[model samples]
Target: MMKQKEAALEFAKLASDWEWRLNNLYYITDKEGRVIKFQMNTAQRELFKNMHLRNIILKARQLGFTTFIMIFMLDACLFRKNTRCGVIAHNQDDAKRLFREKAKFAYDLLPDFLKQMVGAKVDRAGELVFSNGSSLTVGTSFRGGTFRYLHISEFAKICCKYPDRAQEIVTGAFEAVSKDNVIFIESTAEGRTGYFYQYCMDSLNKHRAGMKLTALDWKFHFFPWHMDKAYTLDDPIIVPQRVHDYFEDLALKVGSNFTSTQRRWYAKKEETLGEKIKQEYPSTPEEAFEQSIEGTFYQRQFEDLYRHRRITKVPHSPASCVHTIWDLGVNDSTAIWFVQLVGAQWQVIDYYENEGEGLAFYKDVLDKKKIDLGYTYGTHLGPHDLEVREFSTGKTRKEMAQGLGLFFEVAPKLPVMDGIEAVRGLLPSVMFDQERTADGVAKLQQYRKDWDDKHGVWKDRPCHDHTSHAADSFRYFAICAEWLRDGYSSVVTLPATHQQQIPTGAWT
Candidate 1:
């Protein structure tokens, strides 16, 4: 009787302590298929110690955060009454796997006494409801229920792949959770776009500023691959000079050293991952997003431009004529790029984009540029669709532009893919003013093939997102700039009729 009472007292103490309960009470199957007591690893422990109400984790591949979060949610549901926990994976397969491998598996292997104490009231496909009103649910997205704890796993992939689902999480699942409750949005870096990247950047900025996190503010947590003990190799290979230099530079930036074994492991891993290794096991946050996004049309072109330092200070010359290319949108955004052809080089001087503007507004913009910057305007290239007459006005955009004193020459119609190819060919000889065309340049870099999520393939057409306007305007420039090869004088501002008379040529 005395021994049983003593055991009961110890059990009660362990149950009361969350950390003790996490490690002592739970059992998880490891990657090697060994059922072991769930112990928090270094990265997990560090994250737990500094975790805030709202946390966004940007980490290297497989730090066991998904496992930790699932177990954490399960533990919370078991211990606390009326606790509603939710886990959101990037897809259905991941959601099922997380619930099966972590939550349900650990709960099944729990001590009989503890299991009896907190009996399962409801158990179904993707959820477990405790008798105490605490429950855990895992799915791709959740719509209605409020949650005390919410974990969004592989959010970067969701942002990159299933954008609509990502938005639903932001507007629905995220908003459903209370501000004071725990919410973990964790993922490896995908690219430099989407809400996940934006959130990481915002959190990073706040962290750098040393601002105390409020309930609304997300606390950023970064765990690099080198921090994990399992990342080291037994027989380390010779690290290449370039790889060694990168490691040294990254170490200096992040204030963390990489072991020879870890470096070797990373180098070997790069053999399979190639350009993706940096995204997967990044040494620094900036380095993670530095890689070109997959399926992007201008990825190679942009990479080459950066490599040769072509994107630099491209000052406009008074002697050369400044050309303009435009993508006109009535409801959407109007994008324009100012280019100057000097010998073989296409010097991209400036870019402008605006919404809900008229021909008068754009004409004023041109007049202002002429007066302020002393720009000697050359050929103004418009898309073939510029000749489409408006329903209300019965006037083509070209005619309206001419009336506004902004003369435009209609570019020859070509297939979208052909135009994309033209842009790729033209990009090699292009020099851009980094500061002046920063926004447009960023759009060009992001222009990519539309992903067919259902079929798991990339559609031939470009993704019609915010990047389209700039990309389309640049495509017009690439196609129409062939006319400039004939040496159309910039000093002579040709009349609208003269501009219309310009002959179209076969663009190679």
Candidate 2:
């Protein structure tokens, strides 16, 4: 009877202590499908120690954060009276699976005494209602109820694949929680735009600045794949010298070291993942989103550029004449690039893009740049559609541009794929000014084919987003490069599409 009382006292103490209960009382299915006592891994423990009211986590694939969060919310519901928790997955199937596998499975494995003590009244369809007034719910979105804790899983995928749904969650579900309540937004990166990326960047900036976080402020957390001990391999593999150099540089950047076994694991994984390895198993936050997006037209070429360190601080050489390439957009954005040909290399010195601007504005911009940089102007190349007349002004844009003292040479009209090919061909010889052409480089990195949701495949045409203008301007530059390579005249005269010819003296 004394031993039974002692055991009862120990059980009560464990029940009162949340962390002890998490470690000893709860049961979770391991990755290999074996039920075991819940023990926090390095990543989970680190994240839990620093969690604030609002948090954003950027992580490599399969760090078990989703499972951790599910268990955490379940624990919160069990221990705190009247507490309500919500788990949001990227889709309906994921919601059901997470709830069943993480929450329900663990709950079913609880001791009979604890189960009776908690008195679970409702356990059906992604929800568990306890007799003590706490409840847990899982869904793609929840807008009606107030929640003490909220977790959004795979938010980056939602932002990339379902932008409208992502906005709805931002407006509806996010508003359901109060400012002081706990909210976790976690995901592997998907390109470099959307709410998840923005939140991660903002929180990371605040973290880097060493600013104190408030109830409303988000705390940033990053979990790299190397942090997991299970990521190493027993079998050895040869690491290429270039890859070894990349790892060395990454170590200096992130202040962490990797063993040869880990490097071998990465090397083997890269064989299957190729360019996607960085995105999937990133060592740093910058590398997570810097990789080319899936279906990108210039992924291979951009990888080469990064490998060769071609995207650096390329200085503008006054020895060569600078050329301007443009993609004029009607009712959209106008993108421009300043390039110089020195020997066989193409130096992309500068880039500029603006919306709702006219020829006069661009001309003023060009003139100001010319005076500031002291550049000797060469040919100004534009796409074939530059000659299209607008309703606002009957004259073609080329004529309007010529009127502003900026003459343009029209590039040959080619298929989109052919232009993409031209850009790929020229990328090998191109050197970009990192600071001046940062936005253009980002556009190039993210430029990819449109995804067809219904068909579940990438469409042949490129997705025309903010990136398209810059990419289009570069395509025009590539076409002009081909023309110069073929020994075409560098002079820009009256456009062939212009209705009237200018005097010979206008050439100057």
Q: Residue 72 CA error for candidate 1 (Å)?
A: 0.7
TM-score of candidate 2 on Cα atoms, chains taken together: 0.64
- The worst-scoring run of ten residues by lDDT in candidate 2 lies at 492-501
The TM-score values for the models, in the order shown, are 0.65, 0.64
Off by over 4 Å in 2: 292-413, 417-445, 448-508
lDDT of 2 by residue, 31-81 (tens): 899988889899998888889999899998888898888888888877789
lDDT values for all models = 0.83, 0.82
TM-score, cand. 1: 0.65
Give the candidate number with the greatest lDDT: 1
Badly placed stretches (over 4 Å) of model 1 are: 292-508
CA error at residue 225 for candidate 1, angstroms = 0.6
Estimate the Cα RMSD of every predicted model relative to the unseen true structure.
11.7, 12.4
